[model samples]
Target: MEFRHLGRSGLIISEIAYGNWLTHGSQVEQETATACIRAALDAGITTFDTADVYAETRAETVLGQGLKGERRAGLELLTKVYFPAGPGRNDRGLSRKHIMESIDGSLRRLQTDYIDLYQAHRYDHSTPLEETMDAFADVVRSGKALYIGVSEWTAEQIRAAHALARELHIPLVSNQPQYSALWRVIEAEVVPASEELGLGQVVWSPIAQGVLTGKYLPGARLPASTRARDDKGGAASVARWLRNDVLERVQQLKPLAAEAGLSLAQLAVAWVLQNSNVSAAIIGASRPEQVTENVKAAGVKLDAGLLKRMDEILTPVAMFDPAITAEASPQTRP
Candidate 1:
């Protein structure tokens, strides 16, 4: 696997990171999740990503058990906060109480004394940015977390946080965003802003949650066991991309993928890595073979002509608005 420094930081991580978002401890059986993680390790992946709110808090525990025997010093493990983890009114957001409690909970569940990177899953509009950064600065000072990052944060939020992180003498190294050939929301503003702030992107869903794999045919019924068929939230999340126009356009890219000697999934993952500011692309897997198939994109480079053709085919249906990064409606937590 090829490694890249996360932003301007001295940390080097695998270009293809193994992530367990919807799969571990929820979608698949424990055995299947463990096998997928083992396959990633066999392929030389040194980075793993998870979040505290995934599966209502079971994903992290499953990941910890999966990595029980591995050499912890050889891996870069990451997790996130800022979402509700319980029914209590103070169970969520980036408040000092939440951050302090959440880090301890994560350490216990993840079976690790320290987290390589701890991210704010989303911007907390209810709290001051300084309060959140201050809590994170304490995390770093205590050596519970090595670096800080934010996900789906707008350019303005990133700039503000970066300034605070610098003042606090903490390392804010990366941003995790949903970036792919079809979803270029970060390109117009976030990329440029991150470049200026020395933050590299560790992108998620490079295949658009399986939409870019050409498996969901435009006119066909949703494939059984596929993400689109999942009744538990995953289907609802990807419903917008299930449109016939988007599916048809995705199908047109299959021949181009063949010409480049790649699976449609591999082509999609490699396309995201083409950007110099993207340090890694996080890929989720349900089966071991899926992990093996995606690792092929690690060092592959797509030619300029192919990339141009891909844009020409997909631009009509692409979502590139900078507003896509805006904060969501505040949740009514307990």
Candidate 2:
């Protein structure tokens, strides 16, 4: 797999990162999740991203078991905090207590002494940014985490945090945002600010949660066993893209993908990677073959003309409003 340096940091990561968000420990069986991880490794993926909040912390344990025997030095493991991982009031947010405690818990669950990149899952409005950054600083100094980042943070939030991170001498190298051909919210503001701040993007949902795979046809019934029909959070997460307008627009890109000799999913993933500031695209899977199929997007270059055609087809339905980033985050801790 091709690799890129995250932001201006010295640490390099695989372009296609294996992520377990809604699948492991929740939707998919542990055996299937483990097989997907193995498939990712077999496809030369060395980066893995997860969160303590995923499946109420079970995702990390499953991932740890999946990577149990791999050489730790060869993998770039990433996890996040700032969500309610527990019932207590202090069990969430980016408060010093949560950051400190979360790090240890994540390390324990992941079966690793240190995490390569520890991110704030969302901006914790209730906590002072200073407190959060200071806690992250301590986490790095203590060697529990090597670098720090934020997810779904606004450009203004990123700028403020970057200043604080710089003052504290921390390596705030990346932001994890939901970015895809159909979700261009990060392009307008977040990308420019992150570029200025020396932060690379490790984008998630590069296929718009499978909407861009051309599986959900317009005017069609919800496909059996698809994410749109999932009773779990997946259904809600993908609900916005299930509309006929969006689904119909997605269908127009299928031929473009075919002309590029890529599956719809590969085109979607490659579309995101075309951004020079995007260091990696996070892909989640329920089956091992899905992992194998999506990883082909890695190192695949789409011509400018094909990319232009893709934009023309998807732009009308794409969500590009910069405010969506802040709206997606909790105004107060959940």
Candidate 3:
């Protein structure tokens, strides 16, 4: 596995990160999750990503158990905040109280003393960015987390946070965004903003949530036990990309992958890694073999011609609107 420095930070992470978003704690059995984690380790994946809100907080526990006996120093463990982890009014957002409490809970559940990277899952329009950044700075000073990041944040939000992060002497090193051949929403503004700020991207769903893998064919039956069938929520997330036209277009890439000697999945994953600013691509799996297959994208460079052809094939259906990254307006309290 090839490694890259996260942004300008000194921390080096595997190019293929093992992520348990919809798999652990909800979709897969614990044993399956453990085996997948083991498979990732066997494939030389040292970076792991999860979130406090995933599976209502059970994902972290499952990941902690999966990583049991692994040397902590050798792994780059990451998790997120800014989602509702509980029912109480104080249980969510990037508020200082919630951030302070959530860090301890995540640390406890993750079975780790320090999080390699702690990210804001989404921009908290309700909370002052300063309060959030201050809380993150505190997390760094307290040694509960080593670095800070934000996922799905707009370029404007990122710039504002980076300003504060610099003022506070906190290292905001990475941005975790849903980036793939089908989803190019981050490329226009977020990538340039992050590049200017020295932040690298740890992209998720490089396969467009299996759409780019060509498993969900146009007008075909939804395969049993696939992500679209097993994860209604995830299926909904990928539903837009599941249109007949998109699926038919995706099928055209099979020959390209064949020419490159890569599976459709590997092509999708490698496509994201081709971006110089992308530090890693997070891949989720329910089985160990899936992990093994996807990680092969690591350190594999696609030919320039093949990449150009891929763009020609996917550009018409690709969503590159910068507006997709716009932050939602602040929700008013009643």
Say which candidate scores most in lDDT.
Answer: 2
TM-score of each: 0.98, 0.99, 0.97
Residue-wise lDDT of candidate 1 within 1-334, one digit each (tens)?
9999999999999999999999998998678999999999999999999999989889999999999989999999999998989889899998999999999999999999999999998888888889999999999999999999999899988999999999999999999999999899999999999999999999999999899988999999997888888877488868989999999999999999999999999999999999999999999999999999999999999999999999999999999998878843253322
lDDT of each: 0.93, 0.94, 0.92
Question: Which is superior by TM-score, 2 or 3?
Answer: 2
Top TM-score model: 2
Each candidate's root-mean-square deviation in Å?
1.2, 0.8, 1.5
Question: Could you give candidate 3's per-residue lDDT for residues 1-334 as a string of tens digits?
Answer: 9999999899999999999999899988689999999999999999999999999999999999999999999999999997889999989888999999999999999999999999998888788999999999999999999999999888999999999999999999999999999999999999999999999999999999899989998888888887787554487787787789899999999999999889999999999999999999999998899999999999998989999999999999999998877633235311
Model 3 worst lDDT window (10 residues) = 325-334
C-alpha lDDT (0 to 100) for residue 281 of candidate 1: 97
Q: Candidate 3: where are CA atoms >4 Å away?
A: 231-233, 327-334
Residues 1-334 of candidate 2: C-alpha lDDT, one tens digit per residue: 8999999999999999999999999998789999999999999999999999999999999999999999999999999998899999999999999999999999999999999999999998898999999999999999999999999999999999999999999999999999998889899999999999899999999999899999998898888989889878488889998899998888888799899899999999999999999999999999999999999999998999998888888888888899999986787889
- For candidate 2, report its TM-score: 0.99
Candidate 3 clashes between residue pairs 3 or more apart in a chain or in different chains: none
Model 1 misplaced stretches (Cα beyond 4 Å): 328-334
Better of 1 and 3 by TM-score: 1
